[model samples]
Target: MRKALTLLGTGLAAALALTACGGGNNASAPSAAATLDPANPTTVTVGATPTPQAKILEFVDQKLAKEAGIDLEIKEFDDYQTPNIALSDGSLDANYFQHLPFLEDQMKTKGYKFEHGAPIHIEPYAGFSAKHKKISEIPDGATIAITNDPGNQPRALKLLESAGLLKDIKDDSSALTLSDEQNPKKLKFEENQPEILLPLVKDPKIDMAIINGNYILDAGLNTDDALVVESVKDSPYGNFLVWRAGEETPAIAKLEELLHSPEVKAYIEKTWPNGDVTPAF
Candidate 1:
């Protein structure tokens, strides 16, 4: 049997490791120093977001892990920052929530030694609103809630530009800040933590919010409800599995194999029929 833990709030203190089944003495131990034995089922503790990330892992744990000799344990995180923090501190064997750009930013800024597998899926970024049905409905000088993280803020801004809300955006492959030159409508932006952007958009004062597809799913909001959805065609924002450098084991390899298997791809397509989450492989 597998286990799941929900981590709310920020910081390393909130990222308590969950015990995996059959992990007797090493239940609370980190996988960094564990020995790899191909004959035995390896217990891998992975951190992920609550929606499609954890759900996808749960599917693999229940249906595919045993035959592949992998014992999966999943930890659910509400925020984007904590997973990598947990991984860096040896709290998780791996994580499966971020894309290449976000991972690159984290590694460069924090000096994390990490490696990742191929892109597993894409959670299309989109603009959402509770008060407005379309982008044209947003009035000038309206406040729009978005993620404050540099990794995703540019994505949100690009989505807004596609919707004709912003223009003349110059992204220099670095963390971008919104300026008056890009704000044609003079729309004010309220940047908050990614997890909070959902609820912030619901507020009457906030006009709209650009949120990742997973958060929208977790909140019971339909992807069809989004005012402007990011295109998946040739999109570089595909989420993948990540682990510490040189920590890969046979079990981890098996997990990665199962992750990109036809079963997982079919499962993703079947589960997220609305195209909120699509297989990238």
Candidate 2:
């Protein structure tokens, strides 16, 4: 049987020791002297976004990690930026919330060196709207809201291009200004935090919103409701496990193995059917 998952929220600051199942008097007790032991039981702290990412990690910790001498500590972050920040600062042993494009942008722009594990899964990005029923209905000066995340903004523009509202442009070079010529509708863009895009799109004032897959799932809106969704098979936005460069340890390796384990794949497929979430491995 799977044990209950232990989770730490964003507010948690101090390091907490985690004891493997049946190794301590109380599994939930937090200890400050936690250390890693390759040959024996070890604790690993990972930062992750809630929903599927944290939930998936929780599953691995409960079901497979203990037997492998791995005790997983999951810290949940509400935003995309914090997980990487925590990972880079050594606050977290690893993080499992972002795709490669985002990782590249973080490393290139923020000057952080990190190493990532194998592809874990893809949370399809989608376009949603409250004002327009179809792509053609958008007015000439309509406003479109998108994630301000550097890696995701270009992706949102590409989705707009596919919807027949803009022209195709190279990836990673897109911005609000670049869309002027290709934009037949002369659409305006509002860049904000990814999570904020959901409510903004639902507003009658906003024409469309490009929301991240996990946020969409949390909103309880069906993917079919999206104005347009990215292709699952070819999407490059597969989320994975990432850690500080040159910091990979035995505990990290074991956790990575458990993430790609059959149990996780089955859990993802069963938890989210109809391609709402797809295993990238």
Candidate 1 lDDT over 201-247, as tens digits, reads 77999898888888889988887888899999998899988887766
Computed on alpha carbons, the lDDT of every model, listed in order, comes to: 0.79, 0.75
Question: RMSD of model 1, in Å?
Answer: 6.4
Off-target runs (Cα >4 Å) in candidate 1 are 11-39, 172-179
What's the TM-score of every candidate structure? 0.87, 0.84
Model 1 residue pairs with clashes: none
Prediction 1 TM-score vs. true:
0.87
Across 83-194, the per-residue lDDT of candidate 2 in tens digits comes to 7667766778888888878877767766666777778899888888887777778778888898787888888888888878788666864556674667777888888878
Model 2 TM-score relative to the real fold? 0.84
